[model samples]
Target: MTISPPLHLFEAFGVELEYMIVDAETLDVLPISDRLLHSEDDLPVSEVEHGDMAWSNELTHHVIEIKTNGPHPTLAPLATRFRNQIRQINSQLLSHNALLLPTAMHPWMNPERELHLWPYDYSPVYTAFHRVFNCNGHGWANLQSMHLNFPFADDEEFGKLHAAIRLILPLLPAIAASSPWCDGQKTGYLDSRLNSYVPNSRKVPSVTGDVIPEQAYTQEEYHRKILEPMYREIEPFDPDGLLQHEFLNARGVIARFDRNAIEIRLIDVQESPLSDIAIASLVTATLQRLVNESCTSISQQKEMEVASLRTILDQTIQDGERSVITDRNYLRQFGISEPQVTAQEVWCKLFEDSRKQISASHPDAIPSIELILKEGPLARRMLNALSEAPSIEELRTLFRSLAECLAEGRAFHGL
Candidate 1:
């Protein structure tokens, strides 16, 4: 159930990071998550929970999800707890000769052949999607992301939070596009995983609605506009009606009215927990800036109408920081005074301003933002590394190095 609404605006935060379990040396995706999680007789308990940190299964057996207990007021402790949980999972993974990989998409896993749906408590929920959507595409099978949830107290708060989030949603890929390669080859799009996610729901359009989420304000209106259609569409397949909830509706951002919060699903997982928290901090700060300024009116958001926002988002996903920001009005809305600005400039300005809103000084300034400004997003960095590698074998070696960066809680410096 949704916790009582936050007492203050932007009072708490929660994060979920998804990772791929793979063979340590060969880096092949491992579908042994069930064995790690359920083999109590042969191994220790797979699910571990300590306070706000916990481990759980995902739609695919090769993937697992880690999340905090509830929204946190500070990011440093949250990041610390998240890192400790990763170490705990890695320790257990040693017995299985597997470990979690940091990248958003596994380099060479064919989801159709390798996909293993979680068949425990929510088996039918996954089963329905598998049967209908053929849940084996890169989107369903390989894509991993960082999901950030922020709590709201009431309808007014939800309205403000929703608007602020929608305004910033389009720009997220510019800072967090880490999935550049799929199927062991460079997918031309920087965030190729999103290509699958945004379009994969064509079979269940009622659920995802273009993957960029339409404008939603209150719980009743959101249910009518988004959730009701999904419930109706999935009812024939899901007789038990478990898929009727807001979470399973599959939009880029979901409003958990029961939980009094909105969960943003568009961000890609970053290189390290620190980077992830930095991005989270930037998001919170940017949203808070909008709320503090009281820019909750729908009229103020006209500059970022869905059509223009979608264009910008798609361009960022395709081009990374190099994507040109042509919407002068949209840029101006974000306080980009310059007429000619790139996507990175808008993000940099947000990062600079939003850092002030955060309580802790851990991420005084997001290194990823600076790095993207200097080089590009993680996808571009991966692309540069691919170009430099003398051979395919060398590229594989580089990915192995990238894995090391994730394990150590360090950012990948482009070679």
Candidate 2:
């Protein structure tokens, strides 16, 4: 395999979206990702490339990931490409009465009973994680997310980009929370995927670290402060060193030194590619403005404490747009003069500030962003489609519509 050259800040982007394969009629988890990977041939391959897009397997057999084949100069065309791939995958899955469903978590999956690890290719690594962390839970087996990765040139670029990412991390879930239900009921937290993700590696606290990354701007500082401690802590459980790489550090946003980029793992996969790409566009544009120091100086951004950010993150994970931001200091970072505001207000300001950049780079995303701002995230829209105590069939009905949204590349706007 050949490696691509490193990308400079904002030069390009790589987005990865994970979806669950489920029984078409019942919406139950179907462990058939390998079947999807091998749909074109008889061999059980782990990944299949299709020009600029590719389909790959995740840790769980019930999940499949679709990603850009490599970094692209812009995010404008990926939704259509990803939608085409989803259509093909759905067509193939028709034979098995299974199709791809989008969301950060399955509404009714009992992970303990239904979890199936991918038993091919990198089974050893999965097995190691299962052995150490017990992958048969909601965190490991029943979570899906959209990973937004952007490259940085060097120390100076990395510092600016990382600082911008840290400031925006808490607000991501407010706009992108899609995992509203788990175990056949509302989990109370809007983004249950992230709420569970924060504690997935509780055995090794250094691995997650409050779900907000430390203020380590440079590579040397990141290695010494974040990476080194995590590697040392997980070394005992992973004695053979299978899980000792940069990937092991599961902070919400992680520095991928190998790729010279940072990947934000906090956004839940939305109901459709359109919504996902729109959220990505908004995030990228906002970060662009911040990196250029349009809103605040790098010094002020770097001064944001982890505890304060984590507190906001926790609130958004639970309440999403409705979560109030009472910290005047945090509000000032984004140029908001209000003493306190809802998470949605902060996002409105960001969208207004970054409208020009979004229009220039991803004009297609404007409508979807407007829809989210007006209606709220997918999780809230889903709740609007059902009663407070919806029945199992009601849940199924709502999610089936979400699956259709994925298939048709249309955003979900309640029933």
Candidate 3:
């Protein structure tokens, strides 16, 4: 990982979006990301830098990640930057009869047959992971996500940011869930990527202790409580210590002390960059409110139990926006007075309250956010476009439209 100087809270943000490369006509996973990255040369590199953005390979060769080259002062300009990168990559991929597809997981891919690991730089780390836990599953090869990383200067700033992130994690899937179909059928999970993600590291349970992180705020506490245990647990399996870094701590939100940032990994990548950045804008604004203690104090936020938050996350992962929240205590943390509310209602209230901040900072994102709130997440809209038992051709049609949305930089309004 690259190291940078520490930044104050919310001073800058880093965003990474992942997409899958698929055959143009058939929409099957294509393991030619090396061709996409090294169009001009024979050697395949792990990452390539392009102006203010960079393209990188993931554990699987079909999935590629594009991220801001570094922390940007604001997120307003990133939607356009990411979209432009997507177009350039798409143009290059056309030569090979492949194009980029958006969403969290490929609907019909069989990872057992389609999985191929990147065989170039950083292969050691990927090999270590593959050796410890079998990488031939949906959890390893078929998921795409948008990582939202924000800076925290010191221990005090870390405490507040961690607490605020915990409160907001469960509600994220409600707005961003996009993996409705997997293994050629509905897995009954709106965020099936995350549903599979939780057990990916079950061989060593300490690696991803519940998905919602434990209540460790300070750096010292985090190392002792989270990182050390994870390292100890994976040590026997990894004799060479190749997988003993901070990145191994696979919680939904993790403290990246190497980069002086905390990354939120629960959001599924949407159909377009506009949708991904809009969701990020709303989440940042809401975090600001929590850190300021406008609705609840830092003490109150830290007191939230990991089990309670995990239970809510489980519900949203299965049901998305339709999930109901009967926990008044959880609702009160967000300044909601209602005794009962749908997850969508909770998001609507947060969006309205943070409208001013989002409008001022990310004005371009308003319409996309509104579309998601009104219609439902991309997953729900996708289900709306399908029959009770959708055939493979119907799934292909729906995803092809999504690819066009990615290429044209627009939201997917359902049929």
Candidate 4:
């Protein structure tokens, strides 16, 4: 690694948002990157290879996620910069007349559509996978994901911080808001495309090994204990870390670092810039609180139950807000005086942290996350949009509106 990875606290916040390009008139799928990569005038290429912010890959049209090197503690400033940067990049690609869209799922785009692979390591993994699992969902088609990198103070404050991060893992599916219609009907799961990966991770052994016996990890320890094991089992060129290319999408590189931070893997792309920053701040607060605290009172016996933590993580995505036997000690870790614990209570602590962080770091911004919790996951916004207009057009419009609202100034008052 000639270029040493960026320093912590400075780790650029990364967001992976997916949306399919489509004909405005026909609502048909469009491959803008495909159009550009083989277009008339040559676009400047990234010699660093897969490092470019945008490219035509086996996956659907991906808007290369550029890390924010600027201070991004607030939604207004962050969304403004992110929107401008993305638009500028999209415009360059549009020299070929290709349009860019930010959506969880393209209404008419078929995940079953046959498309070539992106130039990513996971291609081979997913390629072998389709033979077994029917590829109705394009594992690659313009995926909708919200990737957030929460900055950490250092590696020493690990253990429960990392575990707290994972404890909330089940909430993802409930909040998931893309790729609704699969196999010609609503799969009833917002992120069925992303969820496809969950079933296959069963056989793979994670570094932390399912949180039964919590292990503290330093930066080097985490990489060795967690990352290195997967890397060793997986073939060298496979970036998605496919343990075996037979059954899983293996998707892309989703990693978590020790120190003052943890990286999140689930979430679709934001329809607009507002969704991006709003979701980012919401997630960041939980991660920060988890850093210097104990999350759940999950005992070794309870954690080692017949189902196991991994099993819980698997089921929780769709079920949302899963709770096992949690007690008083865990609540006290985060300064919660309440002697009992529930999924919603823990969530309240997380939301409270967001309020504090916003008040201190970003006083003017209203917490968009508050809305997500009160109303529902971003999925509700998408569902309502689709339901009201009751057409594919209406669904996409609602999706975009909810996304833009993440940054609306009206929502940004003294929150």
Best by lDDT: 3
Q: Rate the local accuracy (lDDT) of all candidates.
A: 0.77, 0.92, 0.95, 0.47
Q: Give one digit per residue, the lDDT tens place, for model 1 in 69-93.
A: 7677766666667777778788889
TM-score-superior candidate, 2 or 4: 2
- Ranking of predictions according to lDDT: 3, 2, 1, 4
Q: Is candidate 1 or candidate 3 better by lDDT?
A: 3
Candidate 4 wrongly placed segments (more than 4 Å): 1-12, 34-58, 61-76, 89-98, 119-136, 151-161, 172-179, 200-216, 219-225, 236-262, 294-316, 319-346, 364-367, 388-415
Q: Where is the poorest 10-residue window by lDDT in model 3? A: 36-45
lDDT of 3 by residue, 221-286 (tens): 999989999999999999999999998988999999988899999999999999999999999999
Global Cα lDDT for candidate 2: 0.92
Q: lDDT per residue, candidate 2, 1-415, as tens digits?
A: 9976667898999999999999999999999898878745578888999999999999999999999998888899989988999999999999999999999999989989999999998899999999999988999999999999999989999999999999999999889999888888888999999888888999999999988999999999999999999999999899899999998889999999988989999999998899999999999988988888886899899999999999999999999999999998889888988899999999999999989878888899999999999899999999888999888999998888889899999999875
**Candidate 2 lDDT score at position 278:** 96
Candidates 3 and 4 compared: the better one by TM-score is: 3
Task: Give lDDT tens digits, candidate 4, residues 1-415.
Answer: 5954444442345444444544434445555544434334554232112232333333444333444442244343666665565555456655554445554555556555634344444455556444333344544453556656555555543443455555445444444444555444465565655555444343443422442223334567655655566556544434554533212224222234422445565666655656556666655555555543434342321232323444544543443333432444444545567655544455555667678676665443345556555655554455544543355655455434543343231221111
Estimate the TM-score of every prediction: 0.92, 0.98, 0.98, 0.67
Clashes of 2: 0
TM-score of 3: 0.98
**lDDT (Cα, 0-100) at 116 in candidate 3:** 93
